[model samples]
Target: MTTKTSDSPLPWPPAAEQLPPHLRLMGIAAAKWVVQPVYVLAKLGAADHLAEEELSTAALADRLKVRCDPLRRCLRAAASVGIFRETEQDHWALTDTADHLRTDAQMSLRDFTVLLGEAPMWAPFGHIMDVMRQDTPAFDAVHGQPMYAHLAEDDELARTYHGAWSSLTEGVMRALTTAYDFSRFATIADLGGGDGTALRILLATHPQLRGILMDLSHSGEIHQGADRAFEERLRTVSGRLPDDVPPGADAYFLKNTLHCLSPDLVLQTLRRIRSEMTRPEQRLLIVEGVVQQGNGFDWSKLMDIEVMVNNGGREHSLEEWRTLLSQSGFRLTSAREVLHPQWLLEAEAA
Candidate 1:
């Protein structure tokens, strides 16, 4: 799962040079469109087919029930960005990127992209200017309700949103498990570990460790644990982070969960972890993309705007995380970049 830095990410355009400032201003909002083909590909089970062979456009069209020209156009667009590759002029093959879209990949981001480009997810971008003017969730302005509430009651929306979130997190989970040492802890509770995938890896890697996932009662509906080698060592508790965390657990993993919450919500969740920790060895492991504004436009910084539009959440810089961690009585002990935009951040009770 661990790759050299080259595989971690393409080092440049430097990331910023990928687009001009003005283009970025718009592309930042428009980039959700990039997730569309991924969703379509996943729905068509394109990767599943590619697992067997590179497909000719006609074969893909036959499998997907779409016309060849449309399928070819989509393949062309995806391949241009390296999401898929052309094995020959009219044939397409899956890339490493395809792994993330598979249902059973080590770290699947398939579900995540489904929600990213859906109307509700993309609708918020239209209100960013008003959000800047009014200082409110543009989502509420556009949808007449909060994003979560709207999705919570709508099965289809919830499914798509969670799918998109899962897609965004697939690589993160892969990058995190292979890049860190989790053997010292006997028990770890992922405060918002959706399907217990992280727990699955940790349990497999650390046989003595048993990991619990604490999330909403309905979390299983959207983020069910997979039947895997280490699944027996994993368990799920049906509740929110503040209520579901077990007392005296050795570690709490909050991966990408904080990026969608406001600072107050984050503080409250961190406080819950604090209340559960009394032993010196207890800790919190946060995997997120730290914002490095003015210096970089790495994906994380760009994602800050996406969060802002979608949830009113802002990406935190390393300093921001350090301050927040300390505020919750935790001290950051180490930091490592796990992927191109993500960092494996470790903190212990202060």
Candidate 2:
């Protein structure tokens, strides 16, 4: 007798949606409590241990050689945030998101998660006021040295840092290879190419192009499944950028490298590259997070704050890129969207 409608209000305000403003704010502020546990699990290889089957927290603790209670508590907290699942009390299993934290997982972010837990990296978030009030970088203020310099002095930290970057480059390389054409260039020189992954992808995708991977230190391990035929075509060179970038490459790919430096250094680097150009027809491909102007939000804007706190570097708008290129004696010819949040700003000598 009664016809039920598809859209009907069960209650004026659902019980779950009735959280008080302060409690909601508290949940937001308490995010670190959730993430820290996941970081611990990542650092302890818990995901890899759970990859095979669901296990009791006691089993995971035994494998990791830590106390059971604390580990169980951590797992429960992590489960609360969907990283892991608690099938029952004290029993846990990996979720889809948690599976990626496994060391052997493709495009694993475990190293990056570990780095996020490191004091030198996460400490900056607490000192934003200081970073804004003074010219001193938050990382420098907290750690007594710039982030890069600090990493240089500690081999372990440096390894973790580069490993994190390698993970990111690996994840983005597919998007990049598909978005832009490398066949037009005879040789592509990657500036600050960590682990040579990006260059390898480009080389494999475009057989016509050879690549030179340049970095401050040639430490990143070559890709596991690198094309055997293109092995001879790939080369790695080590040196500081803008100065040490291999000369005369048809196109220079500076992927996410400029955002790590100050504007002055970026300009100097651009000028140095400009001087190295053998022909006016050559291009300088600046691959970076070019912030979109206006009310919309983008990851680049958030990263700009992180860069500010860590190294005083700032992400730029397209107009800013155009200005920087023009000032460095190059003309911004084309800004190609290579994947979301990344752009390839192609420029020629002005």
Candidate 3:
């Protein structure tokens, strides 16, 4: 079956800025609690079961083999957040937003929700203050290892982490491909392209373009199945950045990869990519969340905190991005906001 695709995300929740000062503060403080019920709903596969048919809380609880009262509360909490709806006194049905929570739904966030609630990802936030004080990532301080190293040691966590990213990439690729002209580049290399979701989309959209998927190591698993035709035009390479970059691509992509690295590492990676550009026409495209200025509501501002806590990385502003690119022997050519806060930054060797 052809899975549905979405180029844009669901609308953001109503802003709390309109509320009274005390109520806004209270809502801000209580916001963290909201994820708990949503996590429970995703963890329980409630959306999948609900997709079969709307059922009363008692019946749904029995079907899921969980306590009725707690399940009912979770359903109600989720409903309050627009994830579900209570049709009758106890009857519940999936909302349009809830449909994306289903495991089989295209670009499903079930694993992403699970990842958010998992201790490795969630527990670090509680120590954000400590992390800020020490200049160490909370994930490393709490887990005794870097996030990537920890993932390497835990198979289940690694699957969920990669799966969450892959699912997210599927949703974002449409916008990225649409915003940027990939047809200009004959062969594009996706550095740190996990599971080749972005490449698949690029190749599918621009039929004449070929792609190289380079990562730390190839997982040998193609998401959503790349047929023999796609395989004929795509090549997978196992390598790390600042050293193992594949040569001969017309353009290179570093989507959502640089933000996970330190400033020095980002420079090194970019310098290496700059050195690898044999032709003056070769370009480097970076896709990342660009943190906006001011205290206004920007998703990247919140994501900045998440990355700071989870890894020693950050979302960069437009000025910071230009400075970084200049320092790495590259010139920032263009930066377009393709998917809300996520920007497509095009650069070339200085």
Best candidate according to lDDT:
3
Model 3: ten consecutive residues of lowest lDDT: 1-10
Task: Write one digit per residue (lDDT tens) for candidate 1, span 1-350.
Answer: 32211123432222557667776667555554555765677767777677667779899889878888877777776665567677656877767876666676666766665566567777787778988887678888899887666876788876666556555565566667678877788888887776555566566657899877877666654334456645566667777644456676788888877887878878888887888888888878988888776863488877888877777777898999999989999999998888878888999889
RMSD of every candidate to native, in Å, equals 5.2, 6.4, 3.7
lDDT of 2 by residue, 129-234 (tens): 9976898888998988888778768878777777776767776778877776666789888888767768877777788988888876634455446667777787
TM-score of every candidate: 0.77, 0.87, 0.91
Query: Looking at model 1, which ten-residue stretch has the lowest summed lDDT?
Result: 3-12
Ranking by TM-score: 3, 2, 1
Off by over 4 Å in 1: 1-42, 50-58, 79-109, 154-179, 220-232, 241-244
Q: What overall lDDT goes with each candidate model?
A: 0.72, 0.79, 0.83
Q: Worst lDDT window (10 residues) for model 2?
A: 1-10
Q: Write the per-residue lDDT of candidate 3 for residues 47-85, one digit (tens) a residue.
A: 888887778998888988999999888887777767777
True-vs-predicted CA distance for residue 209, candidate 2, Å: 2.2
